[model samples]
Every structure is written in C-alpha cells, then in structure tokens.
Target: MRKNLAGVRNRLLQVVALYAPGGDSTRVRLHRLRGVEIGEDTWIGFDTLIEPSYPHRVVIGRRVAVGMRVLILAHFAHHGRNRESSEGTMDDRVSVRIEDDAFIGPGVMIMPNVTIGAGAVVAAGSVVTRSVAPLTMVQGNPAKPIARCGIPLGLDTPIKEFYRRLTPIEPPAE
Candidate 1:
C-alpha cells in the first residue's frame, strides 16, 4: 500500500508540474519533490517532460535551460534486456544528465543513457541519441555537433559574443 501510495503521489506531482501555474520555480520545485535531481537556478519551460517512471534517474545541473515541449527520458524498455522495475514494469535503467550551463532548445527529445555536457547547445527540434561533448553545439535527428563553443549561451551572455565564439566543426578529409 505504501509503495502504491508513493507512486500515486509522484504521478500527481508530475501532472501538476506539467501545467504548473507559476513560472520555472514552481515547476522546478514540484519536480524536485518528485525526485528529479535538479540544480539551482535551472529553468524548466512550459510542458517539459522529465522521465515519468524514474524521475530520480534524471539529473539537471545548475543554470541549465530546458525549453518548452522538451522530452527527457531516463529509462528504456527493450524486451530482451529489460530488468524488472519496482513499479511492476520491465525497463532498462539509464540516466539522462544535463550538465551545468547547457541549453536544450524547444521541442527537443533526449533519449536515455545520454548526457549533455556543460555549455553544450542542442538546437530546437533535435533528437539526441548520444552524449554531447562539453562546449559543443548540436542539431538534427541524431544531434551531430555543428560547432564548438568558447562559452555557454546563458541569459547574461550577449548573442553576438555567442555567435562570435562558435568554431564550426571541420569537415573530414576525403
């Protein structure tokens, strides 16, 4: 009964956090209560979905910005390799980590077993399947690195400086 109650409560909190009345703070607070390891000053935008089954497996670092309609998953259900979950489901446990100063653009979907390194940028509508290197910018279906960054594009950084600091990824030699 206790375990079931906890699961119910967690789902309730998740539902509230999804459409939480206030700003980032409210959503962050609610998610924290639901067991997501969120760092200080991180902003979670409207309708962002963290891992529903195992919120504790998702970690967001300080000053990270998760944009609207983003989906971050921390568990995968592969039939052959799946492990039994406490919730009576079968899944493979994987952590989705976003390091400090990372920017996840709107409509992005981050799959399990991947980390977004510090200062990395994931462009809008990208689908991230692998780990991103620190200070890199990525885009597209599998999120290929487009450029390396000198600094994170935070609220305080100037847009011009952000663009100026980007070094494009050199094409491979033929």
Candidate 2:
C-alpha cells in the first residue's frame, strides 16, 4: 500500500510540475525527478508530452527548445491478429536523444529511437520517422529535409544572434 501511495504521489507531482507557471528550470526539476535527462538551459514548452512509458529513455541536450504540444515518444506497441497472446504484440522501448541547440516546433511528433542532431530544426507539425542530420531543417509527414544549414560559426551561436542578424544595427554617429 505504501509503495502504491508513493507512486501516486510521484505521478501527481509530475503532473503538477508540468502545468505550473514556472519556466524551463521548473520543468527540468520535475522531469529529473521522474528520471528524464534534460540538459542545461533547455526549455520544454507548455503542453509538451515527454514519453511516459520510458521517461528515462529520453535525453534532451543543452540549449534545446521543445515547442508547445510537441510529442516525444520512446515506446511503441502494436497488436497482431492474435491480440490476447503476448506474442501477438510487439512492444519496445527505445531511447530518444535531441542534441544541443535543436529546435522542435509546435505539434511535432518524434517517434521512438530517434536522434535529432545538433542545431537541427523541425518545422511545425512534422512527423519525424527517421533521425535528422546536424544543422538541417526538416518538415512534413515522415519529415524530409527541406533545407540544409551552412556550417555553424565554428562555435555556438546564442538565440540573440538570430535576432541580431534580423534587425539592422544602427551605425554610430559620425
């Protein structure tokens, strides 16, 4: 009875933590408590669902942004014709890793055993069936690369760099 209560308590805490107003740090704290490995400065947005079946199997790297309503699944199961028997269904848990600086857009569905390479960008509503290459941009159903990024700046480019490139810098007064 005590064991069951403890499990319930933990589950409750996870749910509460996900929905709470606190930002990425709060989410990381709760997820770590549930055994998911989320790296430094990563922000998992609201309504994102990490794999419940094998939370510990998911590893999110530093500076990653997982957008709202993203679904990261680590387990898959499908029952065959003989539904009652255990052999009829193939059930497996696979690890998922998102490398540093990747951006997973809203409503993306990342399947089991997938690795999103560093600096990759997954467009909104993409269904990723295969692993993405580093610095690529993928989109659409069973996502295919629509664009490949150029070589990174030989180092990490912070998020602010993107905005800086977009908006023109004012020249100093002559």
Using all chains and alpha carbons, the TM-scores for the candidates as numbered come to 0.89, 0.73
Error of 1 at 41 (Å): 0.7
Q: How displaced is residue 115 in candidate 2, in Å?
A: 0.4
| lDDT at residue 99 of model 1 (Cα atoms) | 96
As a TM-score, model 2 comes out at 0.73
Cα shift from native, residue 108, model 1 (Å)? 0.4
- List model 2 lDDT by residue over 98-165, tens digit each: 99888898899999889999978888999998999888778899988876655321125654654343
* Pairs of residues at least 3 apart in sequence or in different chains that clash in candidate 1: none
User: Per-candidate RMSD vs. true structure?
Assistant: 3.5, 9.2
C-alpha positional error of residue 113 in candidate 1 after TM-score superposition, expressed in Å: 0.4
Global lDDT scores for all candidate models = 0.89, 0.74
